[model samples]
Target chain A: MFDDRSPIYRQIADQIKDDVLRGVLAADEQVMSTNQYAAYYRINPATAAKAFQQLVDEGVIYKRRGVGMFVTAGAQARLRDGRRERFFAEVLEPMAAEARALGIAAADIVARIHQLIPGDSR
Target chain B: MITTSALQVRFGDTTALHPLDLDLPGERIYGLLGRNGAGKTTLLSVLAGFRKPSAGAVLFDGAPVFENVRSTSRICLIRDDGMVGDGTDNLRDVLDMAAMLRPAFDSGYAAELLDRFGLTRKQRLGALSRGQRSAFAIVVGLASRAPLTMFDEAHLGMDAANRQLFHDELLRDYLAHPRTFVLSTHLIEEQSPLFEQVLILHEGRLLLQSDLDELRERGVSVTGPAQVVDDFVYGLKVLSERTLGPTKQVTVFGGLDDERRALAGRYALELGPVAVQDLFIHLTGGVP
Candidate 1:
């Protein structure tokens, strides 16, 4: 769950972003309070709060003061934009390198992607 | 800063702790893990100034803590025995005392904590169940928020849910205000994540004190065909091993790099982590 190469809080923040983009969490929706997240995840609340702070810094979430953290009104768009920017590093680049090693052409992969979208006639 | 020099403790003929030295920097949660009678309690007691070391001194910020009210006031130690006071005192009095004496005490938070723990102010400390006592101790430990707070098995009687609550509250309170928290517990795996640094004691001796994250990265487990794993582990320190059917799992403590990984892969060996508890048991000679 934790890697030595990077701070755990950053990884936690990244995971939260992935969740937000995947629609596992909704914008303007209240997220788990830091204490709730810490206990639920069995991690230090400070570390959890750091992760939330990272989201706040990135405008991915906003704090409601005495209440708790809520996904911002445009949280989904911000998350999608942020994730799209990193898609190549996180997904495409690795897949492309592996495919090249396997002698699979980029066109072949694109064809597979379109084939998997059964209703996308275009 | 907290420093102990040549600290020694002896209970009659049994030496509880040998002459030792240690230094703890400011504002970090330290996990003091050891088996029973491994001197955790003794060390914490001395550091908290509840007991004077038989041979040596404990200093807080360069000043001796023993009999030093100013220094002692900055520290709160919650042990299984609770505080030495009128056991008849209701929980409210204890909270009041904490709020009045502890410079950083959070009375409002303490009240909320009491409610969360289902402990009422009017309840006498003596009348409370063991679990309730544990809860009460934890409340004091968290709410005190002293510069240095030590909890020595302070929640031994708490149920799993309440223990979870205790950990959550501890972290939340620490974040709200950072301080030095030293927790001594036998439940290593349960509390390992809370620790930035771990000080492990074995048979009254300081075994290791290192960054918990780094300690975790020092060992790896390799499993594969018996011959391959054996060859890879040859000349390497084997901490433990288990064999069943056609495969063997060997735990080796050392570096595992890309080269080692490729070698293991070539030999059809699988590499994984050695759980902290299993490693601790191996390190401590299976003490309790």
Candidate 2:
């Protein structure tokens, strides 16, 4: 199911990007056609096509003419770097702010972070 | 392309549809939504050439649709009453008639759909259950492959699972062969996503018509402390509002631009998109 906070096409593009960053969709691998994705998700084909167009515009995927769309070379690494830059502002910042509101100190948050990732140094 | 210009229909003293103008291009599915007795059937019937509009015209590619053989053959309307005729006819007879009358009807596809829906060729129309009758109607609709197909509450008798199956099959066939499909139904939440555009009818008038995505973008819910929520929603068209203790949630109708979103972020407000069904309910005054 998709949420309405943004257009479904934008969400579709984001999901593909996440897959690329996680290496679930390897670079140069053929992606599902717009029709296939539309059928799978029970959405309009045009909506799915819009998502594909956005991904193509971002250089995340490229069309192989009649065959289908394929993940562009280095798409995974590019997505990873972009996500890394956003991780702090989109995830950590709000989380740290929530912790502060709840009277948890920065040191305590750091210690909890360390507890979660035992081998990592902050 | 189907275009209606100032179209209106009246029965005796009651106006079923007020003068309305609409243009529906080919190759896209449209959702026609309205409450009971909202003139949805009247509009579709006019489009299908089953009835003549009292005023203005319903045109298919610049030609009038009413009583025109060329246009009527290309337009298919399947109503909830199962337009397959009386119960005396068997499935085979009905399909045979469809093949004889409908130029685009595919008999092979009809057979495949019958088998998929667990229907038999020898079964009489009267013997099938309500759900099966609905399924058979869908079979006729899809296999007809008419350029402009309209299903007006055709799934009323179907169960939730069967309705979902119908949606899937409709989408699959639509993708395989693109055409114009107008679905008039009360199941807004379940079917709205399948539509590229949606037209809402209220009190025999065209209330709103827009791309589904654009309609979705018009509604948003902002929740935070009462003061902050009030400040953010001020001067905006607020559809509905709720308050619990010191927290408030306001559903507003309009695009949430970046500046307004940033303002919400500054206030730590939780902003979320409103579902199409919820927005519809709010727009229609929660008549249900």
Candidate 3:
């Protein structure tokens, strides 16, 4: 499932976050135990546990003591808000740089975006 | 836990293993990687108390390993060619023998594994094919339930489906009963994901030991214009380099620091992550 060059735990953490952002994993829904995740992914349980621990530390997920992990309340909204800021910094910034290097004007970039995106989406 | 201090193995005039030390914690899966003649089998055998070290100390937990009944009982090393009994031995009797020798042996589990592998008790060990024998080794190794189980290419001749079954069964069994497992195999990429820690042996020496994830991050690949790539990797530990027209891809032995990353960014060079198999090849003299 993880094909990236990043650490497996980091890939898993990002995947969980993606799932949460896409509404595949709803807030307040319990996630699979690390062992179950490991068995499903065919990886070491320790790697899965590391990813879960990262989620728990970030408050994206919480433990219910005896029960398994669950997405924290408002975690989706919080994550989306955080990602919105990063998208502009990491993605838009590089795109703007590339456009400038290619001698494309800011207005032309906006025009191209308009041609690709629907008017109602704005 | 398993510990070794300056362990060495010598046969006749040649040294199979130089002085080496390893302290492995309990209940984690470790992947042992090396080319042939890298002393992988020698290391596994020593760890399992099957072969004596010519020099230095071997410890299982806190006790001496070689010939120590208490320590030896906790280990099970399955060699590809060595089963529990002679070739004429019936499969059923082999399980009985394993159950008798290993205190943690689970006959019920063994039978279940055998059934899943499509093997029966009526067949003699000699009558089974090579793949079947490997499957049988896996059955015994997993069912032995030894606290420290080592498989030296135990999946040697099995078909891909059977190998998949072995990995799946191993993961499930390990989840239920946690124990230290040392798997020595040439099938690096296929089995790399299942390891928590990785140990690479080279020239009978302990080359590197690290968390599997950390090891993955150690090797970095950069692809850019040939001239720029050549200038960029100057003085860096370059493991291997490939050139296609003007674009050159170089695999380096260490992570790129912030300065190096900035340099790559300035030139628009693509930085790619290295897989464990690629790193193994570069590190073990397997790649030209």
Please name the candidate that would achieve the greatest lDDT relative to the true structure: 3
As a whole number from 0 to 100, the lDDT of residue B120 in candidate 3 is 99
User: Candidate 3 lDDT, tens digit per residue, B111-200?
Assistant: 999999999998999998999999999999999999999999999889999999999989999999999999998898789889999999
Mind giving the per-residue lDDT tens digits that candidate 1 earns over B187-236?
A: 87788778778898888889999776567777788898787789899988
Candidate 1 chain A has its poorest 10 consecutive residues by lDDT at A1-10
lDDT of 2 by residue, B182-253 (tens): 999889878887898999998899889988888888999999899989988999999999899999999999
Scored by lDDT, model 2 comes in at 0.90
Q: fnat, candidate 2?
A: 0.60
Those runs of model 1 whose alpha carbons end farther than 4 Å from true positions after fitting are: A1-42, A45-122
TM-score between model 3 and native: 0.94
Model 2: CA > 4 A from native: none
How large a fraction of the reference contact set does each model reproduce?
0.16, 0.60, 0.64
Of 1 and 2, the candidate ahead on DockQ is 2
Which sections of candidate 3 miss by over 4 Å? Answer: A89-122
Scored against the true structure, residue B89 in model 1 reaches a CA lDDT of: 92
lDDT of 3 at B72: 86
Model 2 superposed RMSD (Cα): 1.6
